[model samples]
Target: MATSLFKEILFRKKITDDLNVGERKIIIFDEANNGNMGDQAIVYAQTEFIKKNFPTDRILHFSIAESIGILKH
Candidate 1:
């Protein structure tokens, strides 16, 4: 189990290292259009978190009512 976990961590690190901010695209999916404030808040929080952590990566948000849209910084 420990060896498997270590392999997973190393694989993740390799993927992270290969990612380029200019070429990386992150898509966040949510059900915010169902009139749920909590869902909206979660999406908002996630967007903020991603922006904070991956400052240069492109972020896309998709909700139930709308199609794919790019997140503005």
Candidate 2:
């Protein structure tokens, strides 16, 4: 839906709006959920991939609910 897409954009903007220019950071979204094993494995693989490829940049985690909550403003 358009509203969902709009909320996603707003939430992403909210999370990154305060960052400085040329920030070297990677955000892993929805990895903080209490999901099943498949989801956990996906998160683990993503983390390992980022760690292997981008050893210097900082990593950040955010949940889907948390992202949508930011759009409630």
Per-model TM against the reference:
0.51, 0.60
Off by over 4 Å in 1: 1-22, 65-73
In candidate 2, stretches whose alpha carbon ends up further than 4 angstroms from where it belongs are 1-23, 71-73
User: Largest lDDT belongs to which candidate?
Assistant: 2
Count steric clashes of candidate 2: 0
Put down candidate 1 lDDT per residue, 1-73, tens digits, no spaces. 5545433443543544444346876776543766678887888888899999999877755565333221221
Candidate 2's error at 63, in angstroms? 1.3
* lDDT (10s digit) by residue, model 2, range 1-73: 6556645664675754545558688877656577688888888888899999999987777667765654464
- Model 2, position 12, has a per-residue lDDT of 70
Clashing pairs in 1: none
